[model samples]
Target: MDINCTTYELEVLHKIADAADALKLPCYLIGGFVRDKIIGRPTKDADIVCIGDGIELAHKVASSFSPKPYVAFFKNFGTAQIKIPTPSSEGSDTLNHLQLFEIEFVGARKESYQQTSRKPMVAPGNLTDDQNRRDFTINALAISLNKHDFGQLLDPFNGLKAIQKGIIETPLAPDETFSDDPLRMMRAIRFAAQLNFTITPATFEAIKANANRIKIVSQERITDELNKIVLSTKPSIGFDLLSKSGLLQLIFPQMMLLHGAENVEGMGHKDNFYHTLQVLDNIAAHTNDLWLRWAAILHDIAKPQTKKFEQGHGFTFHGHEVVGARMVPKIFSRLKLPLNEKMRLVQKLVELHLRPISLTKENITDSAVRRLLFDAGENIDDLMLLCHADITSKNKHKVKKYQQNFELVRMRMAEVEAKDHLRNWQPPITGELIMATFNLTPSREVGIIKDAIREAILDGIIPNHFDAAHTFMLQKAAMLNLYPVQQP
Candidate 1:
């Protein structure tokens, strides 16, 4: 299949072909760029494989430009990369007006791996050998860059057929493919999720059989693929595959805890696992924020721990939001995910996932809305999104009712925010001012008075103004027999 190359892309191919011809070396465009081109996916990255010194070819191509671009060469890997800058329509010479296209050049080579490590022993080889070493058939497709065979596709493995069939099949034996580099297992699932493709049955079973091999892969690499899957159009496809293939249990058993439901006295709870996926897909429809998606994945993470059976009530996962919030840090640490504000955002959402739901069910009071806005602060909209996505009941009536209540809660939150300005709200009173006014050092009394003022504002007992908080603070302090140093 001939891919319709863009004008700039054709220019790049022509330059590379000219360079290869001058050096008397064969070259082809291979891997993801080729695959995505056939699938009509927009791609900025290209891989060119030559049957000669890749670094030399890269330098030759770099010289073709008026002001030669920098070629980053990796001697150990026999690979080189050139970042070609495209001129912008603005006609500006500034770097901001330039777009970069990454072209990776590699010498055609084969690899052999030891059972213990994913790293391979590389050696120079023909194009067929390089294709044989590819992880998936669809990724093995290559387009020639020689004058005689320019744009001709080389499909030794019928990778074009695999692309047509929307199938992810290994170029070689599935067992060897995954066992050699267990990271491929995650890639398989990621590709399937990204392209809406299916892994061949044999490849799926091989993944299951070699699931334990994933432990050898680095956590950074594993999580990288996991993040890609999470960011896919419909992430649940990849996650469900992970669970069924037994990879989820090995990598993330905490999520597996949400799988099954228990029944007693003719009462049962929804499977929290599937429920979480539904919430994830729901949130995905509204936003592409990875942290928000993570919040959905972990919103009910502690349901298993907090699950309790009651005589009248079927099951109650009390304080699950709080418990799940506590679990986020450890999980993030284990997965090698960034433990920065991103982690805190997910934790905060997990902790507050149920607050909006509770407000929706009960009377939507201004005080409740004020408190929600205060706690959620800048993330109020995200919290509401999570709550809306959390509604996954099979009962259409219940779903409709919850949605209506959610709208009411949103309206109440907006009204209260406009009136009280409670988003990111801190009490008008400060602990330092309270201490100075009372002529006392930092003590439990200051904490008590500070908390009282905050609670009063949240409960609507006093306005969020300094005068009201000061008045209430003095009264509470008077009751505690702690008078101010001097009267105002």
Candidate 2:
């Protein structure tokens, strides 16, 4: 292999080779590390497989370092890890400032999964068996770590050729490989998306045939891969693969549901599925926050549910925000995503996604901006980003016009926010003050007056402060026939 290993990596691998020679064992540096090194991709963690005791090999490797680096071993899985920290992280001058890498040692093993479960029965195997078990040909390549050939490339499956061609193909027959572990199907598509590589014809066919097997995988694992796809430079690539392979329908049926558009009297709505992907890609360019991109993906998710065909209008999705907001929890629950503030943030964005667009339509008021600021609070920036990303029309004039009007809406928001202090702004008057000055208990009158006070504050009838709120409360109180009695 002409793949140049960095000085640190070479030192570690040569150490492993020496240790294996001393103990009379066989081992190889395998899988992702080799693939990444060949492709000039940086990798901090390198995987090594040993025919003998991997734990012993790891301990010896750790001891070989000058300071005797610590070895963390997993006895059950027969694996161990040793961290090689450069001066950058540990601030130790003993090592070069080049970079740090972790070397993981594991016993060469073969696995057999049960028909209904992904968990595998495992036993020690040779290098060939280990290579055959890898998910993809590109990942199946290994480098010798034995005495005879310390850095020899062992490509039993022509992985180098596949890598050169920018192709993702399984080592074995696609169907059998997918049948053994269906998650490989998702992995293949994810790899294709991440590397911008093409899926081979047979591999793509296998994904379609094995789509149902994805149901057996856990939602957490599925979401983990989905999140990786979402975080890719161009996420739309993965969504297209998911849709084509049919796994998208099984894993996230909601997004897949956004697939088609129907024509009513030669008037048709855009294909929301493709539009959502475009919006996701657009949002991705500006921010790398995963949840914010999620908002973009789901901003118009409820259009299908709220679709209405009017005689004059083509299609109106009235109150899709409300429906979309309700759908967030169910989608999050099904995907095993966090049900915490992240979900609520996505829900809020879905609920108010159309509000800014409404501002661009007709005569928008300062009060509208105030209400938007109050509702969006700390999330105003992200909400605006999602709204800006939502402008995905192919019409250049319409796009330019909406952008200009959107900028106006932004200016109005800034003007109103400066004067009113209404981004997450609160009502100046408290219910406690209302009860204290009036000597009243918690009652319908308290709620009624509280609601009125909030309205007055948001409507700009009163400045958002204590004195103005207190003075307004008195007049409103007189109308309700409530007055403080005279003191002795």
Candidate 3:
């Protein structure tokens, strides 16, 4: 098959072909570039595999360009890369109004792995050897960039058929392939989630049989794939596959703990596992934010920990949000996720997810809305989205009622936020100012006055003005029996 390529793409391919011919090397455009093009997905990167010194071939290709793109080669890995800039008009995608065509060159090679490690011992080999080492069959497809067989299609493993069928399978024996590099197990689930493809039953079973092998992979690599899965359009597909393949049990058993529902006095709550997945899919429908999606995945994570069955009540997960928020840091650390603002965002969203829902059930108040806005800060919108996604009840009437009530909560929040200006609101009374006004060093009394001022404003007892807060601070200080020192 002639792979459809833009004029710029064809130009780059022809340059590589010419360079390969000059060096008497057989080169092919291989891997993701070929697969994505066949499936009509926009791609800006291409992988070129040659039978000779790939780094040298990259230099030749670079020289052929007018500006001579820089060649970055890795001697230890026998690979090289160059990024060619193309005008936005001719580019597949533009970044800063300029698009980059990244081409990576690697000599065709074979790989064998030790029983203890996923790192492969590499050596020079043929194109077929390189294809055989690919993680998935669809990714192993290649296109000829040679002269006589220019634009020729190479399908040594019928990967095109797998693409047509929306299937993910390894080119070699599934067991050997996964055992060689256990990271491929995560890759399989990732592809299924990303492309909405199905893993063949045999391949999935192989993953289950060797799920424990994933322990050999580094946390960073595994978390990288997990993040990709989380970022997919319908991430639940990948998470479900991960659970069924037992990879979730090994990689994120905390999530796996949310699997089952127990009946107490013939009253059972929704399966927290599937409910979390539904929330994930729900949040995905509204936003593409990865951290928001993560909040959905973890919103009910502590339900299993806080589950309780009272004599009159069926099942209650009271304080789950608080517990789950506390668990976010440990989970992020374990998964190698960022411990920065991103983690804190997820934690904050988890803590506040139920607040809006609780408001929907009760009589909405300005103080409550102000506190929600103040606590959620700039994340109020994201918190609202997560709460809306959390309403996964199968009953349509119940869903509608909750949605209507939730809308009321939103309206109240907007009104309060407009008047109170509480979203990302800073307390008017600074601790330094409190200390200054009280004519005292930093002390518990200063903190108490500050808290009292902030509370009075949030409670609407005082205006959110420096004057009102200053007056309240004095009253609070007087109550503490600490009068301000006279000005010098």
Candidate 4:
């Protein structure tokens, strides 16, 4: 009952209360807004559940705001949203005092799902009926915003006990709850990962039993949950649960493929699946960058496909990088991820993951360092984080050695970056300049010359500047027997 409300939130609730009173309707502040408030996490989004028309409540609520926030009403779904600025950053030199907050209002409803589809048949219902349909107990908590019992907590399912126990359990029977919508099973695990909570034995078993029903859910919805799991603090925990509960194979068979190790000739490779998770957890510690964390999860994805046992030399994955790079596009497309630069960055990291580690074992040349800087450019730091995370050996000494070597690599990068400035670094000689210099337009020779210029810069063969690149270009052009065009 002791849920603290900020001054801004109090203002929001007062407006909402006024709106509900004007229409003579019952409404409650529910779900995430209530859950987050009790947990003391910062939140600017509110979910208001009204017994009557949610769209009309949203309109009335918007009218109550000072500037009359826009109400985006959806009649078919009985949902509406109003956005307002709510400041959300901390520092001396802060930006945006007022941040954009979203207030979504939906009618209290009960849902029944058919066996074949994930969509539920929804209709207006009483508060208890609405609470019964909640996916988990913790999410079922609601606060009254009506005049008589304003800010009163209503948790019939003892959601507070579940939150205190750090447990994820369904409000209703686990079997029926998950059977109605298998996506709830995923939501249970996702909540466990996000909240770092435990799934009770009954709930866990229900998920395992109903795991196969995940196929009925759309890939986008499934991947959205999968991504949330991947982005958690300890993603491996959720993924391991997904594998154990037999849900992963149905949803993400590719990741499931990384589960085991094969031994041949008294030698073997580490289970890539566990290794990938360790890398993900490690990257999570250093950054909250979601895409960078994704790169860590996928860094060694092609090891299984490229695995082969070589005599005496043991196991080798010769082209896993290339194979993994090739697999990225199809995987992204199938998984409903953006096929833009984010995908490309992941691909580049997978291909280059082993390079810095490989460098650590050798004399560690300047040319190699330059190439890495040039290839990685701005992403060099993230690549290093992934490389550091990739050191998941059981040997403490091996881990220490890898960490030490990474520090050296980072120091070397500082040196190289200072000298060459290759990050977002472009070659001084443009392809167009090369074309004009050699009196050619769009030929294979121009491409060859361009590659050579880039290579020379990456190889530390010359200073990364126009004059040096020009001199190298002329020499390379001479070797190709292409004469320079005279100035007109």
lDDT winner = 1
Identify the candidate with maximal TM-score: 3
lDDT of 2: 0.88
Please provide TM-scores, in order, for all candidate models, with all chains considered together.
0.94, 0.92, 0.96, 0.94
Native-structure RMSD, model 4: 2.5
Model 4, 390-423: lDDT tens digits are 8899999989988898888888888888998988
Q: Write the per-residue lDDT of candidate 2 for residues 169-253, one digit (tens) a residue.
A: 9999999889889999989988887888899999999999989998788888889999999998899999999998899888888
Model 4 residue 54 CA deviation (Å) reads 1.6
Ranking by lDDT: 1, 3, 2, 4
Which pairs of residues collide in model 1?
A: none
Comparing candidate 2 with candidate 3, which one achieves the higher TM-score? 3
Residue pairs clashing, model 4: 85-99, 86-99, 87-99
lDDT of each: 0.92, 0.88, 0.91, 0.87
Candidates' RMSD to native: 2.3, 2.8, 1.8, 2.5
**Model 1 clash tally, residue pairs:** 0
